[model samples]
Target: MNSALVRVPGTGEVSLAPADTPEPADPIAPLAAPWVGLGLSTPDGTTLARKVEKEGTEHWQQLTPARYIYKSQELTVASVFQETKGEVLSAYFGGMKFAAVGTSTPKVYRAEISSIPKGDVRALCVDWIDTVSDTEVYHHRLYLPRAEVSETEDAQWGRSQEARWGMKFSALAPPKGKTYIAVWLTDDPAVLFGAPAVTTGALDVITEDQPRGK
Candidate 1:
């Protein structure tokens, strides 16, 4: 069996930025400022879910439905954040205000969750890395131009376990011509299987043979 065909997120990271921040053009380029990492997450990692709703049109004279009408589509990413830092708290409790105060040895941080706003949209990205060796690695990324926290799980404080913030972000439609979500992959299986490489706005599949940092 070819190990290259198998994919595992050896290391995963979740980052967020302002909704208008430009999506990364280079598949493997390192993320820059404005993109703040949410820090470590639970071992369960992240979950990407897509749900499609459709309605079947039925005719009284026909045995089967005439057609299936597309009703709606929803894309969501859920994860349990292990860190309770300012970034994580701010994200989990949307519309909350976070601040760092004092000149003491360890700066005191606070997150005030007074209200939940209607549309707390943000640009979000999740990166997965699979390292085969020091020089050979595979990267996968999922990006959403506009997303909001749609649901959150209860945060429990216990002496036996660490506190975790669990939340789900629902992808929103971007500006008129922009895609709601984008995905990129390096060392793609399509290229390994000898399929022609095709580049489009919504998805990108890169091979090792291609020039880097394009």
Candidate 2:
């Protein structure tokens, strides 16, 4: 059996409570602070951005809950235009377009990013870090196999802000298998993929402070 043991930082006390203990009154409050990392990659998960772009640097911005909604056993991802410059914007647009159209066709680099006519729906993996703590970090990963770019609204140009790009992606369930949401609480981000997507066995690895993913 796999297990994860959590101990309080700078103290000898273990973090686990008895099985009969009641749950927290407000569970959502614990996950109030979140950090999101968005990346651009091929349908097969290979990153498209060159190393010179400082690939892993994530932009900290407001993610409207109204845009990204999760309910009724479905997860929909969307976002409004936010001011960003350079490669970061490029990567984001790439991911959005890639999700909209499959990569089998060519992409046009004109003023407006457009792809060749094709019906290949690629995949987009959004890695979400919900909570970081002294002992471990909680992660929720969404793998959208049927992701596609939806319609966009016009943006008003003003001196106070630069034109921003709006993105919308729908994550439909694959023909077989369960939904593409994975949850894990671990000290290492690499092990998050091993955690279960559904509620069952979600915390099975809670005691595994140091785990190696296969």
Candidate 3:
């Protein structure tokens, strides 16, 4: 669960942040940008997608164009760990991602934390990916003022991955490219999905030979 503020691939900057909460002071503002792109990696040329916990009761939500999706419980990163369950949703649009975070919200851009240095918010930002090989080679450097950044004509694919992660990350799909992979939960946001982890390796232990839904 090693986490670090990735410098957006091109600009060497980051302009990301967690969503703010009610009372304008709840802190841990993931409530604002509840969904984030965490890490993008090169596929081992294994299965297309794999289910992490398909049968887990934590899996809920049964509506089209889901506002929120749930997953197995989440664990904390503190020396003393606590397990907590939470809603795992992937919004279809950018500003819309924070649409359901609170009652009264701030402008979409302000809601973004730009970086998660501390607190109980968990999100992943997959700003860049090499779709040709299904690998993450670059990310959006948020440090550069968004206004000062150049517009990317090809940044319309991460959303497809986000949607895949919400319901079918483990499912096999046609060969693809540039993936911004991430695992997140609100409660103990510092563990696997939030902040940086002591070790940079991920715990992907599923054996490839096993059937898709074994």
Candidate 4:
């Protein structure tokens, strides 16, 4: 087995955007305007969790369950953001709005906790980069078109450690013609048909250059 396939994410990023923001077509593309970055996460980084609950059907004659019935599934991404900025605060507590007051050098930014409605949703993206060298780098991206803040850890305010906002965003079902979540990567030989890297060129040229027949 090739050991180069082993991945250890050296760095990562988490960002949030308006729910209506269009999903990125390219997995490794840089995020543009209207996307707010939640900076400086803890060393633990981010966790992507998927939970599935199912019911087993029992039969009197059989000791083990005969079959399992599908129930529900949940997908969540949790992270502790070290930044105490307005964007991080707003993301940690849903329905909280961040506003900047005063037009001076020392402007007061406020994020007030308010009644969170049921439909408060946002678009979330998580990125992981594994860099073996300057020329060899792999990028992984997870995108959720519709997601909501489902859980939050306590924010401690003390001198011992930095104030961190830890929260979990749960993916929601997309509209009739949309997707709930998407995970994509770049420069992974296991998934990219042994291609060490992705080539950015014209589609026609790429197809013609391929060894496989058209």
Which structure among the candidates has the greatest lDDT?
1
For 71-109, candidate 1 gives per-residue lDDT tens digits of 999999999999988778888778576678888868876
Which regions in candidate 1 have their CA more than 4 angstroms from the true location? 1-3, 100-109, 185-214
Predicted structure 1: clash tally: 0
lDDT per model, in order?
0.81, 0.37, 0.25, 0.79
Full-model lDDT, candidate 4: 0.79
Candidate 3, residues 1-214, lDDT tens digits: the string is 1223333223111112343211112222322343333322223211122234333233356434433344543221111001111222211112223333435556332234335333223222212222222343322211111111111112223544422221112111112452223222222333233343343356433333434555
Q: Per-candidate TM vs. native?
A: 0.80, 0.35, 0.16, 0.80
Cα deviation at 33, candidate 4, in Å, is 1.7
Q: Cα miss at 11, model 4 (Å)? A: 0.3
Query: Between prediction 1 and prediction 3, which has the larger lDDT?
Result: 1
Worst 10 residues of 4 by lDDT: 197-206
Clashes of each: 0, 6, 40, 0
Candidate 4 lDDT, 1-76, residue by residue in tens: 2355568989999999998577777657788888888989999999999998999998889888888998998999
Q: How much does candidate 3 score in TM-score?
A: 0.16
Clashing pairs in 4: none
In model 3, the runs with Cα more than 4 Å from the true position are 1-16, 20-51, 54-119, 131-214
Error of 4 at 208 (Å): 32
